[model samples]
Target: MKATHQPPTTGDTTPADLLRGAALYIERHGWNQGAFFQLPTRHRLAPACAMGALRIAATGTTDSIILDDVFTQVLAAQAILANHLEPDYDHTTDLEADLNFEVISDWNDDGDRTAAEVVTALRDAADTWDRLHPTGGENA
Candidate 1:
């Protein structure tokens, strides 16, 4: 089957949507965004973008997200689309391009929303979920 590519900005407007989309993309690409020690310039492990997130989670630097864990990164990404997180996406890679799609930005444009903003938004949404006790009901 031909893999699906979601339209630009189709569902990823909110913070939750943005996070889920990013997480989904990372998961699909089999990327583990975490800290890696670049031996040539190593003081400690350095964080890589998506893999950095993973490394940080594995270590004690930051709290982890449900997305991209050893057992459930894939499912958590799907669940982020299905429930809890908002917006959602289909972040499949295209081998012809031989890279994950980059979220385009316009330097001439004026908006608070940048690629960094998108990542932040997603992380915030994930943090919010982490704050919530899933076992408790709505009042909790």
Candidate 2:
């Protein structure tokens, strides 16, 4: 005799289960394709928004004006993930190292600071954000 499989009810689903499902979906469909998937109505919007923010950050395009708040959230997500991987990981120092490798030959000098300096500033902002929102499993 054949047996039927039953999907877990919504009440039985945990956040980790949802995240694992999402990660699997992304792995199968690729990040861009995964981002286009319609988010479930009952789910919190933060994950969807963070996915969008990650897309923007990955593009590295300066054409669109991303708001500071959105960027901060993205950085916060990055810091949180990094912290999870390595407790001693310093996101700010990493950002500075990444910026140091950037090619800014075409970039116009605004008489303010170099690209690496900008990264340092962003790191500072991210530090402030991390302090405000410490990493916790309860969020998951």
Candidate 3:
């Protein structure tokens, strides 16, 4: 299922926009496997995998991905990503739940998983975020 929403281009791109962009990026290029990430410079516009695209969207850089980093933006992005992966996941309520990278990797690396599924997941997650936030994920 292809997402009809286009990536936000305005200066105020929100978290949901980032997710959408990730989906569009994967759609335009292709899914990457067997690596954590590759810069858009390398793979046209696509990151190596779902999580890599999210990280790039969050950090706007190819720096090392430390999933536990306390940085504000990454943490916020991770929360949104985590919530999408598992609806019941709440850091305060369920510490044992798999957070960002693990869950995304498991799904992305599944042998039968196709790029379309990954793109759909990202787009669906973004739609979920929009519905929950209602403010377009800027204040989320």
Kindly report which residue stretches of model 1 are placed more than 4 angstroms away from their true locations once superposed.
Answer: 1-40, 59-69, 73-119, 128-133, 136-140
- Evaluate all candidate structures by whole-model CA lDDT and list the values in order: 0.32, 0.33, 0.61
User: Model 3, which residues run further than 4 Å from truth?
Assistant: 1-11, 38-47, 59-71, 91-98, 137-140
What would the per-residue lDDT of candidate 3 be over residues 21-119, giving only the tens digit for each residue? 667667765677667564456425545577666655555544674344323444455456666777776631234334565667787888998889888
Worst 10 residues of 2 by lDDT: 100-109
Model 2 TM-score relative to the real fold: 0.29
In order of listing, the candidates' clash counts read: 11, 0, 0
Instruction: Tell me which of candidates 1 and 3 scores higher on TM-score.
Output: 3
lDDT of 1 at 34: 19
Q: Give lDDT tens digits, candidate 2, residues 8-115.
A: 322333223322333333332323222322343343222222233232333222124545543443333444433433345454343633432221211212354343
Ranking 1 against 3 by lDDT, winner: 3
Task: List RMSD in Å for every model shown.
Answer: 13.9, 15.0, 5.9
Error of 2 at 66 (Å): 2.0
